[model samples]
Target chain A: MLVIEGLLKRYPDGFEALKGVDVTIEDGELVALIGPSGAGKSTLIRCVNRLVEPTEGTIELNELELTTLNRAGLRRARRRMAMIFQNYALVERLTVMENVLSGRLGSVGFFKSLFRRFPQDDVDNAFALLEKVGLEGLHDRRADALSGGQQQRVGIARALMQDPDILLVDEPTASLDPRTARQVMGLLADLCEEHGLAAIINIHDVPLARDYTDRILGLKAGELVFDGPPEELTDDVLPEIYGGEDWSKEPSEDDEEEEDIRSSGQFLAEEVL
Target chain B: MPVEQREDTVVWRRRDKRQAVIHWFVTLGIAAVVLWCFKLIADDTTWEFVWSAPEQGADLAIRMFLPEWFVDIPQLWRDGELWVHVAEYFRQRGLYAMELWDPLVDTIHIATLGTVLGVMIASPLAFLAARNTTPSTTFVRPIALALLVTSRSVNSLIWALLLVVIIGPGMLAGIIAIALRSVGFCGKLLYEAIEEIDENTRDAVKSTGASGMQVLTFGVIPQIAPAFAGISIYRWDINIREATILGLVGAGGIGMALQSAIDTLAWGQVSVIFLAILATVVLSEWVSAKARAAVT
Candidate 1:
């Protein structure tokens, strides 16, 4: 289980990216964080990992108090939580196998990693994870040579290679097409179920999040305004999260496909409720 | 739409006439300055000597090619043992063809060793100078930048001269000079490469709970490897050229031989040394190109 209390992130320049926020997440649950741009979803996720340190907060993962750990302690704590980036941030010049194996960096000694002499088991596990993510036979290929979806698959494989207890994903599908986005979301959901690993995904696509995740946390302007099951995230609640946007309007021509998905998701949510 | 079009037209028409006048005045001022500089040079120069320069160059070329010893080559070749006669001729002129072999080898060693040393020193300095990797921006960055600037400001020739004075003239001085001169060049390029690495990749590595050193080795080094290899090879190519000339300051290399040849007006030997230098430079260029291609 992961618990965050009174989380605050005020930048050195006096901008608060995350206000006092509190949340608790159980293991084996997939939670989606939904908000408009600059709503602090990314900041919240980053603070959990101490990538962006909290100004004032207590983040307890399993039983470890993450905020109070020193640098070395923080790194050790970070090993249990893997992060996936929006950009599929595999080192583009490195081979796929190398990028996947880099997940063991926190566990491996410095000289061992520097020389790329990862233990046989680590190498085998990396290969296995790559196969699990459906990137088999691509171990020798460079990361940049893969397409966007393929690269994200590699990103997923790398995250899993850490054997993390919890996954923090930031806008994982933001750069992918809709079909690919759904596929990635489904993959993340399946992985979470199979491994019993808790995941918090920050996403912009509300319909996808509603359809896929077990719970949704809606953030608005650095504060969590709503947190509930997908059915409770009604159209009226969206305005609070996205700052007074008209949710009942007809879809524009450019957003026709997304509108269909939204309507279908709403129908599914009503049926489940 | 019509109102917007009219506003656009009015804005285009509202040109400043004084701007054009200022432009013309600036142009005329630049031209006047250029002509004055030209007049100053022309007034002090001898036009007659300049006009005769081509003829003088041709005369020197002819004399260089028509030395008495070179003219006797054909006559000597008429004898049966041409190879032996040629060897004897070189022996008689005190130019034993083999005398330059050690100096040539020393030049290559100086360049290779210098490049290795320079890259070794530059690599750490580059990380310090790179904004993303520096330990402290205020404390370390300025010192690293000052070192880079000071090394780059002085030319390799000047470095060789200074090192010769300090270290006393030898191949060691030449090697140190080349290494010192190359550090700034390699450091500047390497730090820029380090700074330009993808932030996302770095963050990904960091998020894996990797320590700072681990992040650099796994994330940063891989991205910058190609740039590092290319820069090192290119610097080595340049160092070969600079190493050859370092011998001119009594630091040991082919330049020492060339300097001696010039001091005695041994133009034939000077030509030989020039050809050797050209060959060495071409070889270094080829090697550098091949290495860069292989790396990238």
Candidate 2:
């Protein structure tokens, strides 16, 4: 469980990226944060991990106060809340195994991690996670050698290596094609269900979010405008979330094509389950 | 179309006369300064000596390349004594080769040790100078930059000369001088490499709850390793060449033999030492290139 209240992020230059916002996520729930660019979706997820420090809020993770922890305590807390980046930010020069093993950095001591002397169990678990993420035999390859989808798979495996309770993913499929994006979202949904991990995914595609995630949180200009089950996110509320777009227009040919692809993706996701 | 054409023509005709005058003035000023420099050189130098330099060089080349004690062609045909002089020359070269072996070895060792020492000192200083990695920009960055500037401002020869005064002249002075000169070179390149590392990768490493040092190890070091290896190998190649000359300032290397030969007018030994230095440099260049290829 994660609880955030009145979270605010004011940049040093006086730009308020996130205004007062509140959110609570339960265990085993997959929530999609949907908004246009600069809607503070990324900032909200980053705040949960303290990657972006909250200016005026309290964050509680499984009843532990995360906002006021010291540096060491914060690091330990961070180990339980793994993050997946949109760009799959693996060290390009490091091998996949090394990048995955780095997820155990907070658990191991400095010297041990520095020398790359991960425990036997950690190594075993890393290999298992790699297999689980469908990268069964590419552990020795360099991170940059993998394709975009493969790299994101490695990113997911690396995050899971932390044995995290709640995964914070920031735009996981933005860089991938539509087909690969649906596949990645299906994989994440499957992983969440199997592991009972709470995940907050910040995403851009509204149809994918509605079709896949359990719930949706909508933001517009740093404020949470809507929060409900995906079925309740009607067209009327999208205007509130995306700031007064012409929602009454007739569906164009492109929209119909997109709708077909999205419905098929939903069907595929359901079939996988 | 006529109005637009007329307007375009007017605009084209209206050149910036002031700018053109400034450009002409700048060009003329540069030319004047260059001509003044040439006039100063011509006034100070002896033109007769400059004109005679080619003839003087030819005369010295003839004296250096030819020996009056050489056997006549008719005498060689009569007695086969030409092989005797050639064998004597080879024997003398062999003895010089034996004498040069230790100094050549010392030069290589000095370069290796100096490069290692420079890398050791430069790595931490580079972290301090890197904008992203520095602990404190106001304090640490400035100090690191100043140290790098100080190291770079002095040439290795000058550093060797200074060290010889303090250390009383040995391989130690040569090694220290090379190391000091290399610190700035390595640090500047390493810091640039550090600054150019992918910010997203660094943030990803930090997100793993890794401490600062862990982030540096897992994130920063991997990205910089290839650049570091290439820079170190190149510096070692250059240091080998520099080490050959350190002995001129009483720092131990083949330059000591070259200096002694020059002082005593032993041109043959000087030529031999030059050949040895050339061979060492070529070998180092080859090794450096291979190492760089492997690393990158």
Candidate 3:
């Protein structure tokens, strides 16, 4: 179970990313957060673990309020929450199994992990998690060598290795092909069912979200535009959330085809002056 | 458009300040060269100091400091002393000969121990130094920079001198000298490595409710391991050379005998020792390359 009430965050540049948005998820529920790009979807999920700190909000995750917890306390709380990244942020040099075991880093000491002296139980559990995600024999495989689909599967296994009570999946299928995306979504749905884990999946594809999740929470411009069962998600509501009168006018063509944006490292570092 | 027009259209532009900085350096270099030439002609300094035995060391030192021991010169070169003296040294310090065992092993052991120890100290310091990784550039970065400066400010010789006072005369001194130098080097390298890791990986770890320590270990360390290996191994090669020379300060290894041979102006013995040191360094370099390759 999770509770987020009046979660708000504003950028230093004065742009509000999450403007008093609120939502809650019951235990073992497969929920999809559908929105256009920059809909505060990512920001909402990021704030749950305090990755993007809220300007003013109380995020009650488990018993402790995330906004009030100190760094150590937050880390302890984080062990119960796992996030799947859009980019499948696997450590490139580490093997697939090693990357998965990193999910347990919060519970282990710095020296133990550094020296590869992790508890045998954690290692055994990591292998089991990998096997469940269909990467059974690829334990020793380098994370960078895997295909995008395989990497996402490993990402899932890594999150699952945490034995997370709540899963925050941000654009889990954003990079995969339609078939692979469906498979990833199905894998997530199945895991939530089997493990009784609450999951919030942020997705761009409306059709995919409708088909995959039992419930839908729609966001538009840092506001909860809609929240209801998937059956009630109508085309009339889509226009209000996405701002397109006709199918031809909709931005669906540009849906997942956003070009890879590589910001210049030199530009990011130094001031122009 | 014509080719000329196309070429003109593609004219490269430099940022004004960058161009000005480069121009300033060039102008300063030219002015210094002209002043030096003018002074040479005006002063009419004798060319004798360049070739004279007594003044050669001073002149070379002026160009760039030569070892103080090199001040003594025989004014002649011969192969018999070289042959007799070198054969004698090789036979006397059989432990130091290229074909023999202990000295070479000692050199590598010092280098390996120094590199590993330096990395252990520098790894955490690097995190504090990296502007992107550190929470406060004002607080953590200065401490990190101080560590780098302290490590690098004195060369391995000073470290050897210092260690000789504390630990006293042995491989410990050599190892300490190498480690101190490595701290400076690995700090700069690993900080850069830490800065270059993908932010997405960091964000992924942070979202897990992981602490700053967790982010560094799970997210940053895994990313930097290859680069860290490459840098440490590169320093490993440098330490091999430094370790041999460390004995000049009465630390340990082949340098003790090397300084003796050089002090006596026995070129043949010096030549033999130098060649042996060169071979040892080359072999270590090859091994370092293999180790780095395996890691990366």
Candidate 4:
């Protein structure tokens, strides 16, 4: 289980990104963190990994307190959690195999990794994870050579190569096409099921999150306004989380398609302006 | 601030009236100062030499056009016996005299060795200077910057002048001079490259529980590899040109040949040295360009 108590992140400029938030997540839970832009969804996920240091909080992963860990202790603690990025942040020049193997850097010695001499077991696990993530024969290709969907798959393979207990995914589908986004989300959900791993996914697409995740945590301006099963995240609650946005319309299949076209058209109009 | 509402119309200007007046006065002041300096220079000038300069330059060019392919330098060979045969053999093929070959090779060595040494010293200093990579900004960065600035402020020719006196005038002096100058050029460009690296990619690697060294190896190095390569090769190309002139200060290269030829009033041999230096510079440019293209 992962537990966060009074998690606070106030930047140097005194902007509070996470305001004394408290939450708990159990194993095998696929929790979707949904909010509009600047709503602290990304901040909360990064804070759990201590990528963005919290101003004040206790982040306990499995029984160990993460916030209090020193440099070496933090590295050790971080090994239990792997993060996925929206940009699929692979070292673009490195081969997919090398990028995947980099996930094992925490356990490997510096010289060993420096010479590309990863342990044989880690190499084998890397190959297995690559195959598991549906990148069976593309390991030798450079990360930049892959398409958006393919690169995200590589990112997933890299994260799984760490053998972590939980995944902190930041806007994983933000840059992807709708179909690829859904596929990636489905894959994450499936992998969570297969490995019995907990995942905290920061997602902007409400329908996609509801479709793939078991629970939804809604945040608004650094505050967790709603936390419940996806079924409980009704239209009425969305306005409270998103703040005054029109949520009365039915989000049916056809309506979602219309919304996609409308949004894209709005983007095109803005670009022209 | 420059926008104004005049009756029913709105007007926009790049500058307000006061600013435009100031800009006009600044331009007038600059032009007046330039004319005054030119008049001072004209008043102090030797007009006779200025008028005869074209005639003197043409006469020199005619002499330089007929380059001497063979020369007897008593400093070379075993008391002139070996020199005659070698000069005759090379002159038949229209190649440079044997005296120029050793110094040409020495110039190449100076450039190559200097660039390698510079890269060695600059790599660590670059890491210290880069904002994202430095261990301590307040303590270490200023020291690294100071070292880079010291290396940069003095030209390689001046460095060679000092080194020739201390190290006693050899290829060693030329190499150190080039290396010292290169450290600043390479370090400044490399650190800027490091600072501009994709922070997201680095953060992702750090998020994987990678250690500091691992983050650099996997995250940072790959991002900056192309920039590092291009900078090093570009510096090497410049160092080749710089090395050719290092011998002017007694640091050992083609410039020594040119200096000696000028001292003996051998204009033909001086022209040959100029041609040789030009060809070497062009070749280095081509190689560096190809190498930089391949990496990027």
**Among these predicted structures, which one has the highest DockQ?**
4
TM-score of chain A by itself in each prediction: 0.93, 0.91, 0.89, 0.92
DockQ of 1: 0.77
lDDT tens digits, residue span B114-139, model 3: 98898889888898899888778988
DockQ order of candidates, top first: 4, 1, 2, 3
lDDT: worst 10-residue window of model 4 chain B: B66-75
Model 3, docking class: medium
Supply the global lDDT for candidate 4: 0.88
lDDT string for model 2 (A18-86, tens) is 899989999989999988788899888888888788898999999999989989999999999999999
- Per-residue lDDT of model 1, residues B30-71, tens digit only: 999999999999999999999999999887666544455566
- Give the clashing residue pairs of candidate 1, or none: none
Scoring the B chain of model 4 against the true B chain gives a TM-score of: 0.85
Writing each residue's lDDT as its tens digit, candidate 4 over A15-34 gives 99989999999998999998
lDDT per prediction?
0.88, 0.88, 0.80, 0.88
- Of the two candidates 3 and 4, the one with more favorable DockQ, higher being better, is 4
Between candidates 3 and 4, the one scoring higher on lDDT is 4
Runs of candidate 1 with Cα error greater than 4 angstroms are A252-273, B1-15, B42-56, B69-98
- Tens-place lDDT digits, model 4, residues B1-296: 58989999999999998999999999999999999999999999999999999999988886765424225445445465665666664484355556788999999999999999998899999999999999999999999999999998999999999999998999999999999999999999999999999998999899888999999989999999999999999999999999999999999888888888888887767777887888899999999989988998
Model 2 segments beyond 4 Å from truth? Answer: A247-273, B1-22, B68-80
Give all TM-scores, in the order shown.
0.89, 0.90, 0.75, 0.90
Give the per-residue Cα lDDT of candidate 2 at B89: 72
